[model samples]
Target chain A: MEQPEELIPKKEVLRLTGISYGQLYRWKRLGLIPEAWFIRRSTFTGQETFFPREKILKRIADILRLKDEYPLEELVRLLSPEVVPTEVAHLDPLALAPIGPEGRELLWKSGEYAFSELVALACGAEAIRRGAKPGEARLLVEVVRRAEEALRAPTDLSALLAEKTVEREGLLLRAPLALVGREPLLLDPECRIKVRLDLEKVVEGVKLALGGEGRG
Target chain B: MGERNVTISGAGRIEGGSYGTVKIAGSGRVVGDLVAEEFKAAGSAKVEGNLKAQRFEAAGAFRCEGNLELEEGEAAGSLKVVGRVRAKELKLAGSAQAKGITGGYLRAGGSLSVEENVEVEIFRLMGAFEIGGLLSADRVEVELEGRARAREIGGEKIVVRAGQRSLGGFLSQALGFLFGQGSHKELVAEVIEGDEIELEATQARLVRGGKIKIGPGCRIERVEYTETLEVAPGAVVKEEVKG
Candidate 1:
């Protein structure tokens, strides 16, 4: 199908990109998403931004590809074309071509792979930001494993890894128990703990909050 | 006290006395015992005797000219003493790196790294404890590693690389180790929330969201809800014992 030249509405853009309206607005403000690609409304209060169909789709594809390693600013720097004034007569009219069909297909497949990896990476980054060592990422493994187990077996789901005493014999990693009743663990946005479980019963206990998958 | 900030400097002694919140700067030295609500010392301060405070912060170059002590109403925010600290209870929130002997109980909410030569005469924990230095205690309890000196002595768990002539504690009670060594009984949790906590070597329960590697010669009690948990062959983890 021949793509339209005008910018797509917010709902359509969000449907294509799987991003929220708030995220898109923030990205635009941060220059992660190009302002040139957006069509602004003529009015003030009712003003809304629209994404050009091709440009928005391309940006979505690029965002999916680079979400793992690159931040929004870096992605913009790499993908956005250099702007030249129309008054310059000797400027090159050369425009960067969109990723080809084969490339786009590869990117679609790569999106799935990137999604899972980005989830794990995002979790890791959050942990480190909280002053945890990189090696502490294993905490998520147990979380994911319990989530998987819960999906596989439809039991109580909150009694999987109960807190049990284990001797520190020949063990390499000791579990930190400083998060009993503090911050609500955000297992994605919807799932959050209202009450904390016992520290000892946490292991093998399965009140896990799964992210993106296994929520059903 | 009404939040009075007192500064001690230049080879001074307060004998056996008390204050509100002390802010020691500029090569200050205290020879006698001190009791205060809060104490902060920086720039080559030396405390010759015991110190008891509600909150203690020692930065820059500090020396425990004598024994160090703290009480339930006292604590240390960040303690870095090159010399020995012999107290009944030592609680720290920030990083603590002490070389001298810790005669009494030691507790911290943050990371604890000790030099190879220093010995923790008594190691106790209300939080996590990380020891890169020598630890010699009757009993030890920490969320992370117990004592990781280059050559660790007897306690409960001794897990570190490149160590010889090390004596590990054998089991007499449940879980292969006794729990009564002037140390409280506490388990590591995946997440803890408070003003502070200490990380221990043996029971470093972590709330992980990403990849983690339990290093060689280390021990893990439990790992709750994380992305990945990779263990080296030398690492050991005991099964969880449910109540």
Candidate 2:
């Protein structure tokens, strides 16, 4: 008799990525994320969580382009069920700034990058413009950073979740179903992707097809 | 005291550890402290010291130059401040609205609205909150809206509609993305206005009240509701899901 494919545990996937419990289940239900590959263990902690290389990679790519224009349920339906790998582009520079007196010192030493950009980098100015608190936007920025890193190298998912800075903790890495691949993922208009002015103009020319502004 | 009225002019101060009910009219000044179950300042009242009260109301123009603390006992009152205010916690049932509110902790049963400008190092709310300026907080919940800018954001169901954008709509999208996808429970949303809705990083059963129109600008995380979902042609979605 032939043996079935080895299955990975969900816990392991979460531990490897550091995504939140809520995110994991949300993705699973959306179908953007595949079902958990469970493995029975013999030890006391007799369960394991594993994800397919392709499935997780695809999700990472899709999440990076997350937007707030469409309902989550609808997005799942619109997304293509295909997997393709892509190369990692240049690592963007992330800026952070200190707030309080203690944080001011951190800024003097350049340890603080521009958090404003980080907020803009995550989803866009929609949240902030829509009255989302700075702290809330900052969290989403960090999450986006982690998501990007994971997409670049799914195998080294650990590195994608490393500390964003000395004082900051990279908790966003814990979200489940980290995807990393070259599959063409749709970029939501709500995401605050900082596109160069020249590139933005070009994108605008192309985006006219959909009758929307492409000032990313 | 039933409804006794006390009027004090400029530079004068009133001192009291505890009272039944004190009503201050005109530009009454309090230098010492006031501890009562109910305190109302009609015109402009300034307190240099702490003002502890069970129920506090500032109708027209009220200012708190010092800390204002309230016990959990008094949680069924509207603590409204029109003028400048500096209090710790204005515990009330309705909402806490102030021009300039500076304090440590403020717990409100209803919404927390800060008109003009508000500068607080730490502000926490239990219901929908709206701020005009910078609001630095460790945690937040329900719905939130900042007219100008928001320093940080954290909440389960938050709606912040400012400028041309809608805060409530953004929150609904984020919630849908995080909780609405293929969730065992339904993620329902009712929009009485336009036909545009987006869900990002949320999961739950979704039910829209108006025409379901998804924009190309949307980035959804998941969607797995028990019932079928209907969408208008303009809707653009990109995510994953299962039946």
> Which numbered prediction scores highest in DockQ against the true structure?
2
Worst 10 residues of 2 chain B by lDDT: B186-195
Question: Candidate 2's error at B153, in angstroms?
Answer: 3.7
TM-score of chain A of each: 0.33, 0.29
lDDT per residue, candidate 2, A116-194, as tens digits? Answer: 2222242322234444444444444444344533332222121111112122365333221211222233333333322
lDDT of 1 at B106: 59
Docking class of 2: incorrect
Ten-residue stretch with the least lDDT total in model 1 chain A: A90-99
Q: Looking at candidate 2, what is the lDDT of residue A69?
A: 58
Put down candidate 1 lDDT per residue, A1-216, tens digits, no spaces: 222355676546665666543355445534455545556554332334466676578667766776676666555444433211112121111110111121221121222322222222333333444444444433432353333323222211221111223347765443432121211233333232222222211211111111111234
Q: DockQ scores for all the models shown? A: 0.01, 0.02
True C-alpha contacts between chains kept, each model in order: 0.00, 0.00
Tens-place lDDT digits, model 2, residues B1-243: 454334454435577566777677666767667777777676666666667776676654455544566542233324444455554454444445666555435555345566543333234443345565434322222222221123222111232221121336644444344334332221122111111223322222221211232332222333322223433344333432322
lDDT of 1 by residue, B1-243 (tens): 455557767545444467787777667766677778877776666676776666666755555644465543223444565555555566565446665545445555444556543334345443334344334453344442223222223332222222121335432121122223333322332222111121223334331212344555445554322234556677665532211
Docking class of 1: incorrect
